[model samples]
Target: MTAPHHDLRQLQRQAGELDVRLAAARHTATSADQLVTAVVTGQGKLVDLRIDDRALYGANAQKLGLGIVEAVRNARNAARASSLPELNALFGLQPPPPVAGTAPPLPPAPLSPPPQARESVQRQAEPDDESFEEFDFLTDEEPESGGGRW
Candidate 1:
């Protein structure tokens, strides 16, 4: 194959460096109620959480948990949104246009061997002959029927 163009190589190098920087970037957000805060990396990992003491005392456990989850989601969303344009441009990504009132087509099913051919292959791999029957280890005398150990 022909060598890549110098300009293309340069672009790829720049994209790689940008990817490293983006992965290290972090975004933070507080919950709507101002009771929870979360920090998330651009890669969508939650790195830190801070919950106000008032949140624990004033709200039910479930309500406080929900607030924390919401804060993390908001932080991740902000992080992703900030990098989306640059990442898309660097990778030359163009999302498909939306199709109105119709669901996206399903992926095609995987191809498979015919059932008869599959069975034939399995049968060929198995040894049907009783060659092992030549051995007679069960010919030993029967155990004594007495209750006491022999």
Candidate 2:
């Protein structure tokens, strides 16, 4: 077989390095007013959260709540983004803005084995002798005593 390309090996190495970085770090993000801070870790853990008391002021309570939600999601996005170089290199793509909802692609399933040969191989693998015993209901009938429960 021909030797694999050097570029492929380099990409693999870059991906490995990126994976290591991703495993050890986290990301933090806050809303526009700095009222909330959200932290997310490499293994998808939400490590810490902080919200300013002023965030709940008067008419802005709803906006503050929305900001908090946005902060948390953005924090996770940042973490995923931090690891994107590795992911892109690994997948041989330019890269994408990683997000919390995005799941890594799963490997494709292998092709099915040929049906006729598969059946033949299965038949050969099975034992030649087969069991066909059946139980009879009266095989162990006991002599009844009319005096007691039957």
Candidate 3:
């Protein structure tokens, strides 16, 4: 009767339907060469693997292994890609409501410093003699440079 109770019941029904769909979800893929085939569930469990007899006939073992992996990956990717659109539709989701009106008033214009404060900041930024000193490492008092070697 109330809005919250109705929403909860609708959500529970949708969840039950989604659970049923997920339990039924499956994807199958075969390698490009049709040598390997794989079937996976929405939960990404490998339900079946099939290898053609011709695939095993003098096929490189490593290549066959790679083909099987590729098939499984393709199946999982297909399952994910197909399920996403269905779930989105079931939930009635859309692209974020297009930013209502005048772009949220532009964050209150960033509070600039007054001219006097800016001048003070500029004066402080200028280097003073007390902040730095030049040092000469080659001043004529070093023993090795004065031609005295131990």
Candidate 4:
């Protein structure tokens, strides 16, 4: 006899919905004085930049760029805390994934900054990683759709 009907298509639909929602998320970060801010999409893409009037008075490219990045990243962290309850439940702050049959992902070294932002604050002065504890995604394997989706 044929197997009972059990199409996996429903699982695929759920996976699509999860990815769509993730792609639409946005995070924010701020300067200590709230003078500068940047919004970064969930995918770590810079989305918007906001600067207070005071920030513009004597803004240097280096400082301004740094503030924007920091602010956006800060916001992103906060968003993660508020949003991915399910991911946290599953991963519990585990690091990135690993090869199919290998150990988990190793802690990666910092890479070069984007060419456009040559004068990046992070590039100029290597800040202590402890200072920015926002990037929750990197700290853990953010969950996507269950494998059954595929």
> Against the true structure, whose TM-score is highest?
1
lDDT for model 2: 0.62
Top lDDT prediction, candidate number: 1
Ranking by lDDT: 1, 3, 2, 4
Query: For model 4, how does the per-residue alpha-carbon lDDT over 1-150 read when each residue is reduced to its tens digit?
Result: 233224345545655665565567776667656878777654556778888877655434335555665676566665554445534323445543332112222222223466667656556655533323222233243334322211
Cα lDDT computed for each candidate against the true fold: 0.65, 0.62, 0.63, 0.52
Separately for all candidates shown, the number of backbone clashes (residues 3 or more apart, or on different chains) is: 0, 0, 0, 4
The positional error of residue 127 in candidate 2, measured at the CA in angstroms, is: 75
Q: Model 2: which residue pairs collide?
A: none
User: What are the per-residue Cα lDDT tens digits for candidate 1 across 1-150?
Assistant: 335687688888978887687678777887778889999877778999998888866334436766887788777777666666666666678542243112222232223468898777767765643322133223354334423222
Kindly report which residue stretches of model 4 are placed more than 4 angstroms away from their true locations once superposed. 1-11, 59-62, 88-150
**CA RMSD of each candidate after superposition:** 18.7, 20.4, 21.6, 19.1
Cα-lDDT of candidate 4: 0.52
The C-alpha stretches of model 2 lying farther than 4 A from their native spots are 1-20, 94-150
- Name the TM-score of candidate 3: 0.52
Model 2, span 15-130: residue lDDT tens: 67766767677777776678888888764468888989887775455466667777777777676656655466467676554553344522322234688977776677656433
Candidate 3 lDDT tens digits, 83-107: 5555555577743223221122112
For candidate 1, what is the total of clashing residue pairs?
0
Candidates' TM-scores? 0.53, 0.46, 0.52, 0.44
Candidate 4 local lDDT, residue 118: 61
